[model samples]
Target: MSTNRQLVSVDYEIFGNVQGVCFRMYTEDHGKKLGVVGWVMNTREGSVKGQVQGPADKVDEMKQWLRTTGSPSSRIDRAEFSNQRDVPDLELRGFSTRYH
Candidate 1:
């Protein structure tokens, strides 16, 4: 990390028992509840990948939710987050799921 500034958006890859669970749906719902915009999708590697954008603090809270409250059937091992800054413009309109 070069500079420490407010992060407007973030990218994440959630690992462990994250697949085969309705993680994407829960994530989308949670993001909307937190007033964030992003997309979550199932990766071929049995992981979940997504990006969330909003106020810095809300984004952090959303990240925490992703790391903790995955679907009831899912066990979240960890959520690796990045791109903590450098978002000049919010790209996502609303939280959604991408099928791949």
Candidate 2:
């Protein structure tokens, strides 16, 4: 039988008018629906930061959704993605708004 390995982590910095909108909530909803495990939050720099761990294909799908149709009221200026192998486990029970 084949072993099921945990997928690598993907860190993304989504810029543009991601703040003041329901970007985080949308992202969380979409991510969870896509079977991704992570948390999304607004940074102090008016950007949204999120890390998703799942199969590579699913992660790519999540990224695309975030860039295109996730935030209807926001414009996605930039989306930077990177592979992270050492990210700690996260307990993303629900979507939350963080003030920093």
Candidate 3:
């Protein structure tokens, strides 16, 4: 069996009731737990946006989590994923929440 794993990167923006709901915190925790590296931040437009990169399966799992589940008080109306591509290796070191 092949020991090498395929990696992928994706950009996502989540809409609806995401801001001020601990969404970025949960996202960072979940991404780390899933062994993925990424960053999440809140937008001024009242949404969440970030980029994730990791093994293909792990990335997929993270995507699902972003789409369906977030912080307890969060209401995820929709999630839009974009800029997906295959990468030779992980670009980021760890998951985190960005503040601006």
What TM-scores do the predictions have?
0.88, 0.78, 0.95
- Across 1-100, the per-residue lDDT of candidate 3 in tens digits comes to 2323988999999999998888999999999999999999998999999999998889999999999999999999999999999998889999989988
Runs of candidate 1 with Cα error greater than 4 angstroms are 1-7
Report clash pairs, candidate 2: none
lDDT of each: 0.86, 0.74, 0.94
Could you tell which candidate, 1 or 3, scores higher by TM-score? 3
C-alpha RMSD in Å of predicted model 2 compared with the true structure: 3.1
Ranking by lDDT: 3, 1, 2
Top candidate when judged by lDDT against the true structure: 3
Tens digits of per-residue lDDT, candidate 2, 1-100, equal 2222445577788989888778888888888788878778888888899778765567778878877776778888888887666334443544444456
Off by over 4 Å in 2: 1-6, 86-99
Cα error of candidate 2 at position 21, Å = 1.3
Superposed model 3: Cα runs more than 4 Å off: 1-4
In the predicted model 3, the residue pairs found to clash are none
